[model samples]
Target chain A: MITVSIEKKLRTYGGGQALKLAAEFLTGSVTKIYGPSGAGKTTLLKMLAGLVRPEKGKIVFNGETWLDTERNIDMPPQKRKIGFVFQDYALFPNMTVREHLQYATHDDAWIQRLLAVSNMTTFTSHKPAYLSGGQQQRLAILRALATKPQLMLMDEPFSALDTQIKIVLISELQHIFNELATTVLIVSHNLSELESFDGNVLYVGNQ
Target chain B: MDLSPIWLTLKLAAITTLLLLAIGLPLAWWLSRGRSGIKLVTEALITMPLVLPPSVLGFYLLLAFSPQNGLGKWLLHTFDVQLVFSFPGLVLASIVYSLPFMIGPVKSALQQLPVSLAQASYTLGKTEWQTFTCVLLPNIKPSLLTAIVLTFAHTLGEFGVVLMIGGSIPGVTRVASIAVYDAVEQMDYSSANNYSLLLFAITFFMVMAVFIFNKYHAKSPLE
Candidate 1:
């Protein structure tokens, strides 16, 4: 289980607002986070992944104190063992599809399996620029999974995919998430898109 | 006309470019990644050569390299090395003169990269060194190419700094630029014109090579 209580400063057009979040995620469960624009959904994910620092917070992951303001204990992102899919995909332009996975791990079997799951085996030698938008998005997902991280944070993971690809990929992802028993926190604006995942919904912002 | 000066100039530019890569890479990396008061001060100092008069820089360097001074004394005592009016001195002066040309491009390249790439590498359990070498370096090839070519070209064109510190010593301190000045002083217009044209052609070739390589690299499938 993972527990978090934090407050971060966010600057919007109107003024600055405090994004105070408190939540607990059960082990091996997928949690969908939805919010309006500029509601700090991505910030919440970053904070959880130890990429963003919160003004005040205590985050405990499986009894490990990742962050405790009162105790002055803060774990760096490198030690967190979390996978994050950036909104822009963040694919290394120079690295090919296979090279991205090779960068994360040396396990050949695992890499082949990931490539198969992402359906990008044929495009292994293709760089990000040569890949289609959906292919690039899938490669991003595959790269995040390359490390087999325990916790995955995805920001609009399917924003670039077509509806058909999104549906099929999410179905495959559901099985993989279950098999890996990884806790996932995905942020998306559209709720209906996540209907197939069957995860608990956490809405942010003033609706 | 002796072509030794031409070879000497190429050697100096080559050596200076290599040294700048060694020194400037780390400095540029630090300037781009570090956020501290020291970074600001160090950045200003590094950039001083860009704006300062070459003669002024050379004057200070010459003083520092003289055997009577503290730095020169320490160097001579420790290593029995002399710098002023020597080939080593010219190389040192060239490095100082061309530092910004190398560092500016590298720092800008590093700064332009998205923070997420580094973050992604970190989350993959890779160390900072691994991320820099594997992730960051591959993405900044163009910047490295630009830095190398610019530093080499800039070093080739250095005259005032070379003149003030190194003087004209054939096959030693007398680089192509200095040699051209000597030719003009000796009323050898034909030799001066030859030397000038050679330097111009080299600089032009280097710049053109950079443009062609960049265009070809951009068009390649890996891009």
Candidate 2:
């Protein structure tokens, strides 16, 4: 199980406010962070991924205290074993599809499995720039899964794709997650887009 | 054809380019990724050489390398190394002279990289060094190439620093630019013309190649 409890202040433009929340979940369960822009949805995800520090709180994942600001314990992102797929699909431009998979996982068997699951077996030699938007999204998901993390954090993963492509890719992703039993936390403003995924929704807003 | 000076100038340029790359890459990387205050200070220092007149830089270098100075005295006493009137001394001067040429392009390229890439790499269990080498460096290859080429060509055309510190020692520190001046002083106009022409031709071709490659590969940076 993963547990996150954090309190942080958001400062932008000309104002600031504090955010406080506590959440917990079991393995293989998908959790959707539903909120409009500027509601601290991404901030909460970043804190859980160990990319951002909370002013006062604790984050415990799988029995490990990843962050305890009061106790002065803070684990970096790499040690947290949490995969984050960025909104922009931060694939290394210099790396090919096979190399991107290899960067996170050295095992050929896992890479081959990911390629088959993501339908990227045919374009193993192509670079990120050459891939279409939906193709890149699929590759991004496979890249995150290659690390075999206990939890995956996706920030607007399918927002860039067209409606038809988005539906196809989401269905494929749902199948893969079910097969692997990987827990996922997705952040998005679109409620309809996320409704199909079997997950509990966390409605975040100004507090 | 006075090939000796030409040969010495090429050697100096090549060595200075290699040394500048060694020193400038890490310095630029640090400056680009460091805090704003540190970045400001390092940027000011790196550009100081560019702003100062080359002769003034050479004067300070000459003083610093004199046998009486601390660093110079230690080097001479320990290893019999002479900075004034030596090939190595000219190389040191050229490195300072052409530092900005190497640093500017590299720092800009590094700054242009999305912060998310590094953050993503870190989250993927790669250390800072691994991310720098495996991810960042490969992406900034074009900028690194630009830095090396510009520094090398600039060093090839340097004159004032070599004149003050090098003393135009034949078969040792007499680089092409100094040789041109010496040839003109001795009234050997034809030889000076030959050396100047060859230098101009080589530098021209290199700059043109860089421009042409940039034109064709402009879209490559978006990736």
Candidate 3:
């Protein structure tokens, strides 16, 4: 289980907005965080992943202290072992689709399996620029899963896909998440899109 | 025709380019990561060479290393080394003279890349240096090429700095540019033309190669 109580300041157009929240996520549970624009949903994901720092917080994952501002114990992102799917996809233009997976892990069998699950086996040699938006998005998800990370944080991960692809991809990924028993937190503006996943909903608001 | 000047110029340009790459890459990486008053001031100093006259730098180098100034005198006494009117002095001048060419494009290219690229690498458990070399630097290949070409060419074409710091000493201090001037002063039009044509041709090919390569491999929009 991962427990977090954190506060961060957001630089909004209006003024400085404070984001404070406390929650506990059970191991192997999938949760969706929905909020309006500028609601700091992404910031929360970043803080959890150790990409962003919380001004005041204590985050404990499976009894490991990832962050404790009062104790001055903050784990870096490299040590967090969280798989992140960025909002922009953030694919490396220089690397082929297969290389992205190869960079994450050396298990060729797992890499081949991931490519097959994403239906990207035929396009493994292609760079991100050559892939379509949906293809790029799928590649991003597969790359994140390459490590088989125990915790996954995704920010609007499927905004580019059509309904059919989204439905199929999520279904495929759910099986893998269950197999790995990964705890997943996904942020999205539209919660209905994730209805098929049937995960618990967490609503975030800016203050 | 004596070709030592041509060889010496090539040697200088090659050494300077290598040395600058070693120093400039890390410096540019550091400077691109953030903004601070000190960083801005350092960037301005690096960029000053682009606008300031080369002779200004040449004059300062000459004064500081003339064996009369304290630093020069100390070096001369302690290390028995002389910088004034020497090939080493010419090298010092070229590095300062060509610094901006090596730093500008690299810093700008690094800054232009999406910040998410590095963050993504970090989440993948990659180290900061690995992210830079494996992810960031490869995306900025064209910029690195441009920086290297411009620095080499600019160093090859240096005149005022070489002349001010290193007087025309054959085979040691006299480079092709100074050779051309020396040839012209003696009304040796043929030798001057030879040096000028060779320097022009070398620079032309280096620059042309960069342009052609960049056209085919321009920095991608995604980068």
Candidate 4:
């Protein structure tokens, strides 16, 4: 179970204001963060990932208090056990696909499964730059899963891929999620992508 | 052709380049990621020696490291070390003189890195140091090479700082640049010509190698 109630401010076009005004989420199950662009979706994800600190609030995940700014308790991102797939798919450019998958996991079997599931076995030696957009996104997803976190946060993971590749990878992702039972929170402006994801959605907007 | 000065210059360049890399990498990382005000101040300080005449910088360093100064006194009494008119002193002065050559390319390379890369590494359960060594260092290879070559070449050709602090002590602080100057001053045109040609050839080759490598494998910061 994850529970978060955060209040933070952000700078707007000309001035600073309460951009993330009173955001709240209480979920007993895996959830998705569905919102349009500039809707503070990424901000909320960053906060949940422990990358950003809320001005005044608490974030409790799996009975552990990850953030309590009032109490001066803030766990860093590494301790949060939350995996984030960046919008640009921040794969280490220097590492091969196999190394990327290997970085977050100790289980060779699981890595093999991930490579086979993502259909990246053939290009395991290639760097991220050599992979296509869809291939990179698939590698990013698999890399996140390699960590075996309780929750995964993906920010527009498929925004860069073509329609066909997006559909195929999404199905593969659904199968992997079902098999691992890993909770996921994906942020995307694409409503159709959210519809395909088998999870509850957090619709974020201005109050 | 006297090979001693040539050997001395190579040794100085190698030592100076190694020292600069050790010192400059962390300094560049801090400057790249620090707050704007701090960054500005440090940037100005690092580049100050670049724009100023090397003689002026060397003069200040000489005073600071002289036996009369507090640091020099401590070193002399505690460690039995002297900074002025020594090979190590020449190295120390060369490091200061060639600091910007090491820092500039490194700073720019580190600055061009997207914060997302580090953040991603953090999210992957790596500490700041691990991320810096594994991800940041590898990505900035070109810049690191440039820093090494430029700092080495700059130290090889260093004259003012060596002249001011090193005092042309043969077999101790008399590096090739100072030796070349001494040769010219003594009107030993053949030896001076030999040293000058050697320096010119070395610097030309190193600079040419950097440009060629950059041309073939120009790394985009995003990559």
Pairs of residues at least 3 apart in sequence or in different chains that clash in candidate 3: none
lDDT per residue (tens digit) for residues B175-223 in model 2: 8898899899999999999999999998999888888777766567743
Q: Specify the highest-lDDT model's number.
A: 3
What's model 2's lDDT at B98? 95
TM-score of chain A of each: 0.97, 0.91, 0.97, 0.89
lDDT to native, each model: 0.89, 0.86, 0.92, 0.83
- lDDT by residue for model 3 over A1-207, one digit each (tens)? 999999999886246888899999999999999977887899999999898898999999999999999999999999998999999998899999999999899999999989988889999899998999999999999989998998999999999999988998999999999999999999998888899886788988853
Q: What tens digits encode model 1's per-residue C-alpha lDDT throughout A47-116?
A: 8888888889999999999999889988988899888999988888889999999999899999998888
Q: Candidate 1, which segments miss by more than 4 Å at Cα?
A: B219-223
Q: Judged by TM-score, which candidate is best? A: 3
User: Which residue pairs show collisions in model 2?
Assistant: none
How much is the TM-score of the A chain of model 1?
Answer: 0.97
Clashes of each: 0, 0, 0, 0
| Selected candidate, larger TM-score, 1 vs 3 | 3
Instruction: Tell how far residue A81 is off in model 3, in angstroms.
Output: 0.3
The regions of model 2 sitting more than 4 angstroms off are: A162-168, A175-181
Ten consecutive residues with minimal summed lDDT in candidate 1 chain B? B214-223
DockQ of each: 0.66, 0.72, 0.80, 0.71
User: Please, what are the lDDT tens digits per residue for candidate 2 over residues A81-111?
Assistant: 8788888888899899999989988989989
Per-candidate RMSD, Å: 2.0, 2.0, 1.7, 2.0
- Candidate 1 clash pair list: none
For B27-86, candidate 1 gives per-residue lDDT tens digits of 898899858999999888889999999999999999999999998878889999899989
